[model samples]
Target chain A: MHVLVLGSGQLARMMSLAGAPLNITMSAYDVTTDRVVHPLTQAVIDQTLDQAIAAADVITAEFEHIPHDILAICDKSGKFLPSTDAIKAGGDRRLEKALLDNSGVKNATYYVINNRADFDAAIQHVGIPMVLKSALGGYDGKGQWRLKDSTQVDTIWQEMQECLNGSAQQAIVAEQFVAFDREVSLVGARSASGEVAVYPLAENIHVNGVLSLSTAIDAPELQEQAKQMFTAVANSLDYVGVLAIEFFDVNGELLVNEIAPRVHNSGHWTQQGAEVCQFENHVRAVCGLPLGSTKLVRETAMINILGEDTLPTELLAMEGCHIHWYGKGKRPGRKMGHINVTADYSGELQRKLCEIAGYLDAKAFPAVHEVAQKIRS
Target chain B: MHVLVLGSGQLARMMSLAGAPLNITMSAYDVTTDRVVHPLTQAVIDQTLDQAIAAADVITAEFEHIPHDILAICDKSGKFLPSTDAIKAGGDRRLEKALLDNSGVKNATYYVINNRADFDAAIQHVGIPMVLKSALGGYDGKGQWRLKDSTQVDTIWQEMQECLNGSAQQAIVAEQFVAFDREVSLVGARSASGEVAVYPLAENIHVNGVLSLSTAIDAPELQEQAKQMFTAVANSLDYVGVLAIEFFDVNGELLVNEIAPRVHNSGHWTQQGAEVCQFENHVRAVCGLPLGSTKLVRETAMINILGEDTLPTELLAMEGCHIHWYGKGKRPGRKMGHINVTADYSGELQRKLCEIAGYLDAKAFPAVHEVAQKIRS
Candidate 1:
């Protein structure tokens, strides 16, 4: 089967790699250029967009930010998986919050602000020390503002207003600050035939709002709750393909943070840790094939190699380390690649994390060092 | 670095997949078309052959049967790994036998027959009930003859004489048939810097001379012997890249059968069973990167899917099964793809193998059924 992916990025590249061994061909459209690129190598294909679209048997997205017009074209084809509505909900915080509330899933209490009156109401309802984020076009802490006290609220509000001055949609979401014990994410897939499979909860650490590291956690209670949340959201949306839901673990209680309607960075560990990776599972789900096993086979820790033009060659020599360079030119704060290390025990996994951290700049990767130190102590 | 491969087949395809995550670009030459194909996707490139060759930082071969003229071009570049000499030795049974004898490795007693006089000597030395094999252009039981009794010797000799009548090199080897307990292969790699790492020995079973299944064996003594054999051969050859040596286990004693200079079918289980796969290790050896760990993470069994146009979709749902389709046309005796199943225990692995065998034709896949039945019993 030929699968057309909406974005040509690392996730799409990896999905193509996983699909190749299953006789599943992938054609990716560059969202920025609207041109076709080979999914596995990211080389510009010598074909037009129409030709690529015509060849695809199914359509999916690597990310939710695909333009609405392109999504409309795929929707007309009746081959798109997970529905455009699901992508919209994943991209827009307001729609996602509504879905969470409707599903009775616990999330940080929040309010939407489209004007001064709404902002005032949000402040009154969500209280101080809240996070003000644009309902759309926000990721990795971009398009976001943090309110520490009343003194800075007006300044942040003016900044948001200025940013939204000429936008068609002038709205933001204010969420109550959640003081959580740890951050975690659950990645799962739902087939077009209504079959669902969820991987284990992965404890995550984000630095400067970009994912730094993620390790699979074996908390049965939290894992069960996470599975329930995934099922409720996926079944309600009638989702097809992989879905990743991030959560904040607050003293054992889980709260929804956000959801990604595609294969996610947090689930990259599954490539080396689980019987079936998230990319393969996503392909199987969209292609109307049965989902593979999601069983975790090892204790895995994934470390993002952000913005580094070169990694130490010694890292490859480290036991259990697997490097995944994206073959993209390095840019500051961009995810250039990642390394996954698997171990038989949590202690060994921590030691490996520390070893990897040594090869990286500690100041630039404070989250990695923090986790390493936490585990060391 | 960009890597140019000599052959564009599934082995090259998998090598490219393994190299991509290491920031390595693989460009493969289709020996038939003499054109460049993207290794992972098999899409023909629009660039010129010289341009592709100029862009490559190193040259390698996916298989040992590369034409000598192309080997000369790559040799002139001085960037080819596992030098042309090693590949030549691997392709020619005579040279390989000489190397085995020089290394003091125990192989089945054999004699070369180049003419009628030599054939008479071979018959006298090797006796009846021997195997006659062409010194060149042979694989998977082709170009071979088995002598069960003296009555068939002259007939087979006349057939070989007819086929080799016009050939420049008219030669074959006759060997005393070995009665073996099982077939096994040891896959290992030697870096340019002389670093070597060996994976666990894989117990292999072949049907009609095509490998059908291989399981990682934990026999310490036999594994040690295999490692020693690999090390002696690799060190003597000054090899850099993965090497596979097939052996016969006769009454607990190991006897060398053949050697492959590149990754072998017997090592496909490493994809999901080891910390690093044979493909990645080969890439590392040729790229001057440090070798990753060869630690086996799970007990694995690999099954080849040969010549079939369709596979049951339900097989994907089987726990621990990983499919690898080559995207090749279905032809009798062609390797279309393979499936790998990994489990935590030997009993569980066998059960999974039986489960896979159920999806295949019992008659065509008697080897699979036999093993499944043996495991069940």
Candidate 2:
């Protein structure tokens, strides 16, 4: 079967790699150039976008923010997995919040702020110590503001106003900041047949709102809650592919932080730790194939290598280290690659994580250091 | 660093896939067309052969039978791993035998038959119930004659004469047939820095001389013997890439059958079973990168899908089944692809093997049936 992916990034490249062995040909639509290239396909690249789309049995996106026009075209084909509504819900904070509320899933208390009156109402309802975020086009800590006190509220409001002007639909959501003990995420796949397979909850560490490290947590209660949240959201959205729900573990209570309606970076460790990686499971779900086993074969820790192109040779030489260098040009703050380290036990995994953290720049990889500190304590 | 592979087949494709995450670019030289294409590279296919060769930091072959002229050119560059001499030894039966003998490796008792006198001498020494094989251009049960009785010697001699006419050296090897309990092979990699890592020996089964199934065997004594044989041969050849040595396990004694100087089919299970696959290790060795761990992460069984294109979806739906479909046209007796099934324990692996064997045609996959029977008994 032929699958057309919307983005031509490393995720798409990996999806193609996983699909090739299953006899599933993948072609990526480069949104910038309007050109299509089969990342790991055996067929030579000669087909146009329209030709590829016409030939594809299924269409999916590598990232959540697919252009509306392109998504509309795929939607009309009736072969798009996860549906356009699901992508829209993931793209817009307001829509995602509404879906979570409708599904009876517990999320951080929030209020929508579109204008001065709405902002005043949000401040009155949500109170201080809240995060103000644009409803659309916000990721990796961008388009966000933290309100520490009334003194800082004006400056945060002025900065958020710029986001309102730039956004097509000028709106933002203010969420009450929860003093969470740890951050966690659950990544799972739901098939068209309503079959769901959820991976264990991953304890995540984010530096500057960008995920730095994620290790599969063995907390049974948290895992059960994550599964429930995933099911509620997936069923509500009629999801038919991999979905990730980031949660804040507040004194053992799981509060939804965000949802990614695609394969997530937090689940990268699955490539080495689980029987089937998230990328392959996502492909299988979208292609209408049976979902693979999500059984964890080993304890794994993933460290994201952001912006750095040159890596130390010793990093590759490290035992249990699996480097995944995205073949993209190096740019500051860009996700160039990641390292996955697997071990037989959690202690060994933690030690390996500390060793790898020592190899990376402390400023660039603050999350790794945080995780290492937590493990040491 | 860039690696130029002198064959654009599935082996090269898999090698490219494994090399991508290591930040290594691989360009494949299609000897048939004299064109080069980087299999997993982000770079587009637009460079000429000379340009690719000039740009490559190292050169290697996916298969042993590399053309003499191309091998010579690569040899002149002094960047080719596993020198042309090793490839020559692997290509010709006589040269391989001499190397094995000189290295003091125990191989099948054989006599070189070049002329009528040698053929007569062979019949006297090797006796009846022997196998006569051409020294060149033989693979997958081709260019072979079985002398089950003395009465069939004259007809076999005339048929063998045609192979002599086609061969450059005009030679054949006649070996005394031994009843073997089972077939096994050892696949290992040796780096330029004299670092060697060997995977556990795999018990193999061939149907019509085409490999059908291979499972990683845990017999310590046989595994030790296989590793010693591999080290002896690799050190003698000064090899610097993945090498495979096929062995015949009679009772408990191991007899060398043949050696392949590249990644062999028997090692395909490593993709899912080992910490690092053979292809990845080969790329590491060739690129001067540190070799990865060869630790067996799980028990695995690899079944070759020969001459079939239409596979049942149920085979994929089966738990632990990993399909590797080579994008090649199917022809009778041709290796179309392979299926690798991994399990946590040997009993689970045996059950999975039986389940998969039931799905395959009994006649076309007799080896699978045989294994299933053995496991059942």
Candidate 3:
């Protein structure tokens, strides 16, 4: 089967790798270059988006931040999976929040702001200590603000107004902040036949607003809560593919923080630790194949290799530690690659994480250092 | 790092898949067409073999049946790994026999045949009820004959003479046949720095001399004996990549049968059963990277998908079952792909294998059906 992914990035490359074993060949439409290319080789194909869409047996996206015109064209081909509406909801915060509300999934309370009057009303409606996110384009802590007090509102709004001015479709979403105990995510796949399989919940750690570590946890209660929300959201969207829903675990109750309508970073551990990896599952789901078993095969943790391109040579020799590089040129804080650490049991996984921490730079791998310290303590 | 592989078949394709995760990119030299191509896609590259060899940081072979001229050119590039001599030894049965004798490994007693006189001499030397195999270019039960009695000698010799006429270097090798208890293989890697790591022994089953099934076993005595022979063979070759040694287990004693100079079919179970599969280990060893741990993570069995394309869809939902397709056009008894069955324990793996048999056609998957019946009866 031939699959054409909409984004030529690490996710698409990984999907290509995962799909090949199942006899699923993949090509990607580079959103940046506007060219069709082999995701693994990054070799540009002499084919247009129209040609690729026509050629593909199935069409999907590695990300949600694609241009709408292209999405519309792909959607019109009747080959796109998980629906373009799901992609739009993931990209636009207002739509996501509304979808969550309609689906009856617990999410942060928010009000969309297009002008100063709406911002003032949003402050009144959502209250202080609010998290402000740009509706259309903000990601990775960019185009965001924290309105901690009334004194800072004017100053924050000035930046927010600038962000709002970039595109007419853009707006600020002022959300009522919910202090959370920890962050976790549920990555699951829903087949075209409406069958769903959710992997074990992964506890995620963020460093400076970017994801740094994700460890698959055996929290039965949290997993139940997350899966319920996941199923509700997926069924609501009529989704068909891998979907990742980030949760803010406040006390014991889980609240949806965000949704990624594609294969996600938190689920990368599946490559080494799960029955069927998320990348392969995503391909299987989108291609109208039966969803594979999402059972946890091992106790595993994934450490995001942010910014750094190389790891300690000794780490390669370490049992259960597998490195996956993105084959991209390096830049500061980029998602260069990730190391998946697996163990027969949970305690062994923690020990391996600590050992991994020893070989990693504390500055470069702050999340792992924090996790190792926490484990030690 | 870039690797240029000889033979753009499934082995090279799998190597490309395994290498991509570690940021190792690959292009393959298709010996048949004399074209450089991507191993996975088989897309003809615009570059010549000379250019690919020049561009590669390391050059390796997926199969040993490469043309001598191509091998010479690759060897001259100063990048080819495991040495062309090891490849030659793997291709030629006479050199392989000599190599085993030099390596001090226990192997079958054999004599080489050139003409009718040599055949008569081999009959006198090795006696009747012997196995005759071509010296070069024979695999998968091809170019072979059996001398069950004195009466069948003339007919078998006629076919042998025809085989010898194909090439000047070609001859027949007559071996005293051993009635083995079982056939097993050991796949291991020797690094550029001489670091050796081997997985547990896998007991293999062959149908019509083509491998049909391989299961990772837990016999400690056999593992120890196999490892000793494996280390001896690898050390004698001074090998710098993954090498597979086939053995005839004669009442718990292993006699070297044949050696594959690259990753072997018997090791495909390692993809899901062991840490760092043979394909990746071969890549790491040839690229001069650290060898990954060869620890067994799961009890696994591999069922070869001979001459088939699609499998039962219900198998996809089976936990511990993973299908890997080679993306090849099918022919009668062709090695089209394989299925990997994994479980937490041997009992579970056996049960899963039996379950897989129920879903597979008996004639199409005869070995699996045989094993399943044996387990049940």
Best by lDDT: 3
Task: Tell me the whole-model lDDT of each prediction, alpha carbons only.
Answer: 0.88, 0.87, 0.93
Colliding residue pairs in candidate 1: A21-B325
Error of 1 at A317 (Å): 0.7
Can you write out model 3's per-residue Cα lDDT over B316-369, one digit (the tens) per residue? 889888899999998989999999999988888888988999999999999999
Question: How well does candidate 1 match the true structure in TM-score terms?
Answer: 0.98
Global CA lDDT computed for model 1: 0.88
* Cα lDDT tens digits for candidate 1, A185-233: 9999999888899999999989888899899989999999999999999
- Evaluated on the second chain alone, the candidates' TM-scores are 0.97, 0.95, 0.99
Write the residue-wise lDDT of candidate 2 on A226-276 in tens digits. Answer: 899899999998999999999999999999999999899999989898888
Task: Supply candidate 2's per-residue lDDT for B138.
Answer: 82
Candidate 1 chain A lowest-lDDT run of ten: A162-171
- Per-model TM-score, in order, reads 0.98, 0.97, 0.99
Docking class of 1: high
In model 2, the runs with Cα more than 4 Å from the true position are A40-48, B38-48
Report the Cα lDDT for residue A274, model 2.
86
Instruction: Give the TM-score ranking, best first.
Output: 3, 1, 2
**Model 2 interface DockQ:** 0.69
| Cα error, candidate 3, residue A53 (Å) | 0.6
